[model samples]
Target chain A: MSLAFTRRALLKTAAAGAAAAALSRRTAAQASGRVVVVGGGFGGATCARELKRKGLAVTLVEANAVYTACPFSNAVLAGLRPIETQQFNLDAVEKEGIAIIRQRAVRADPQARRVVLEDGSSQDYDRLVLSPGIDIRFDALPGYDEAAAGTMPHAWKAGEQTILLRRQLEAMDDGGTFVMVAPANPFRCPPGPYERASLIAHYFKTHKPRSKLLILDAKDSFSKQRLFQAAWQELYPGMIEWVSLSSGGKVIEVDAKTRTLVTDFGRHTGDVVNVIPPQRAGQIAQAGGAADRTGWCPIDPVTFESRLQPNVHVIGDASIAGGMPKSAFSANAQGKVCAAAVASLLRGEAPAEPKLINTCYSLVAPDYGISVAGVYNPRNGVLTDVEGAGGTSPVSAPPSFRAQEAVYAEAWFQTIAREVYG
Target chain B: MARLASVLTMGGMMSVAVVVMVKTMPAAAQGVAPPGATSCSGCHGPGVSDAAVPPLHGRPSEEIVAAMQEYRNGRRPATVMDRVAKGFTDEETRAIASWLSQQP
Candidate 1:
């Protein structure tokens, strides 16, 4: 059967159960009304599935037919996991009666509650869910553009770029340097760059002992600094080096052809260069008028409804969720909350005060792991970390403890992937 | 406490120690999963090949409560649950367990 939808059954259900919901504070709720979700990554896919489960007609628009997840992608680069394992085809969700539109969302017509696709077709929604993860600010730095990405290889989005960087590493001479330039604050996965460095360092230790890895960081410190530094000392000592911003580690420009990064005071060259650029909300979010000057969509803490657009909600990395980092775990959590709120709004009921949780586990090596977690509760109109109840992996833990965490890290992936994708 | 807060302000995901105390919880509600309870499914999700974490659906509420209380009080050793358990009140935990129990 065609995958766009199985409307024969859906129309029968909609006709049988005409909803009798009260008029919403803003607009009347249609229990069987359409919800169009943009982006099929963690947040949008989860939201689409949840809305369908709530007995709503849901459509998910995505640029790619298949999704490549970013979580655990660093392992793919280090040869710890195969790239095939990172891919997800939404067969499970498709069978659940969700219409998966394989097309790019070019614009969002919030005023008409419609989404315009690259092919000029449009889907009208009673409610719109925008979960466009992030867009790399391509020319934010000089000498770096779409063409430069072919050479430098951001690999930040996973998939083909991830393999490009890995192949480059494999082809490099044993003694050649692999350098990564990490972006400043407000990026996806705060602990990600350090974890990449650690796992890559592990790969070097086993295959090319003479090779070295260098990190040119925009910030002087990062999440789980002590744990990562300690793991580097114990697992791959003297094989990795970090350059903090105070020491001119921040790259002002780059020469992609020459593989050189121009910092404030000096120039550094590497056999392999990975540039993680600054980011903003995806194109649709900006086009839909959901995003603000900060390059992120501001939303109500309770319902995640866009502050700028009525009947439109933004979640995941694109939304400014307080005290929540841009991680898949956070996106999944936000997806649930946003889905529930949309259901309630359609039913003309006030949204509930929900508690959100985030746990980010980073593998410093195949066997060594570190994490940071928090529970975000609503406080004074914002989500705040619950007092006395959130923290990172404890310092000075034994090797066995780290090993156990590594096991849990894999479980975390298996469980979340099944929940969201299926 | 002041020093710890200063450290947390950097990453903003740190926690303070909590004294675990058991208290009377509300009777479980039916129909829908609680707000905080949905987050649990992100990790303790559907029973698929049975990995390191156990799926929570359909377990007895009493059994789930006892386990959560133990983790909250540090009596049960866990990689991360000890910290997560302290985030919820006894009432919230009981409601979630009740919801999970009602699930098929």
Candidate 2:
């Protein structure tokens, strides 16, 4: 089927379902509407659960059968966590009576209120929630493409690619160089790259003490720089090396077959290279005209509705929520809030504009963790940061606090996992 | 009579101290803004540039609240913003929203 016809049919079906549900609830004191959510990650999953709990019929779509988290996938690289530790089934959410469709969304019909599926089937909804995490813009990086990724893994997606990178690390001999190419900003998990480097170093410290690690970063300063540096100095000094943008750390090209990473400064060859390229909103956003020049969807903060499309909402990593960082937790929170607004609108009531929360924790080592938190609100339809609303992990903290941070990090993972899948 | 006066002075001093100790303090120390509102302009104001960090003034309050709430709730994964929002109350967030809406 053509993409256009598919979208129209989906929208028509949703409108008809909504009309029938509305009539059925006319005397029931509550209205029913179908809210279809794309991407079953942290953002989409939580939003689906919230909508379902609020008495809305929700259909959740995901490209994969199981959910794997990138937050602690670093531990997978370090051998601290087995791959299965980060894997979760959607059984809990399925038990909640949410209609689950294990298919990737190909396109969104904003006018028709339907999502086109990879299998050529489509679903219609009164409200659509999109939270597909991110799209790796490999073309943005010279010499890096799908074919190149096969040779040099960009394990940014946190599933099979993660294991592939880990296996590559395991195969390297002592004194071998492990190269990590950090992506530009506006990507998921700001602290992820640093945490990943720290964990990989941990692996080499015990197994291959003479081996070295090099990080070529696109940005000058990174999240939790001080804390990460302090931890690295204390734990594994002279083992991990970082080159920043000012020092010519930005990777301009790569020869994956040769395992060489070329920065403006010089070329460095490594036995294994993990290159994370620039990112943008997921494919569905680009297909729907929701993406901007920067490749992220612009939305009205109050409604999460696409600025270009009237009834379609974008959430998670796919939306341009300026001043807001994309994280699994952030996406999940936005999903719930978006669900609330969508449900209220469907009920013919004005949606309550809401405050949002974001918190990110990065484990510097097995025993150490640091985090930052913030509360955000909308101003003039643009998302703005709240002042004095959030801060970072304390520096030079006592042992008790460090230990406590580690405990909190684990608890946080569990909480977010449940919020998304359950 | 002098002795009696001294006793009364000491007793009153003790009473004041006890009362002060029992009184509840606000969530954050003094000179702080309430949650979700004008309280954020303190550090996020102009003249404080953290590289690419954008200024929070003159933006929409609805977006501000959602962003703040996103930080506080861990929906947005930021390092510093999340910690700052842990101190907010829902009512204070509304108050902050009101104050931000009136700003430029």
Number of the predicted model whose DockQ against the real structure is largest: 1
TM-score of chain A of 1: 0.92
Measured against the true structure, the TM-scores of the candidates, in listed sequence, are 0.88, 0.77
lDDT of each: 0.82, 0.74
Candidate 1 structure quality by residue, lDDT tens digits, A208-286: 9899999999999999999899889989889889999998899999998899999998999999999999989898999
DockQ (0 to 1) for model 2: 0.11
Q: How would you encode candidate 2's per-residue C-alpha lDDT over A1-422 as one tens digit per residue?
A: 36785675455445534543443354234434877888878778878887887778777777566678887899898889899989876668867867777667898888787788887877767778878878889889999998888888888888888999999999999899999999888787888999998888989998999999899999999888898898899888999999999999999999988988898779998888999888898888888778889898999987798898777889988888866778876786687678778878888987666667677777777877788666677888977776766657877876556655675577567656655664
DockQ (CA atoms), all models: 0.34, 0.11
Residue A47 in candidate 1, Cα distance off native in Å = 0.8
Error of 1 at A222 (Å): 0.8
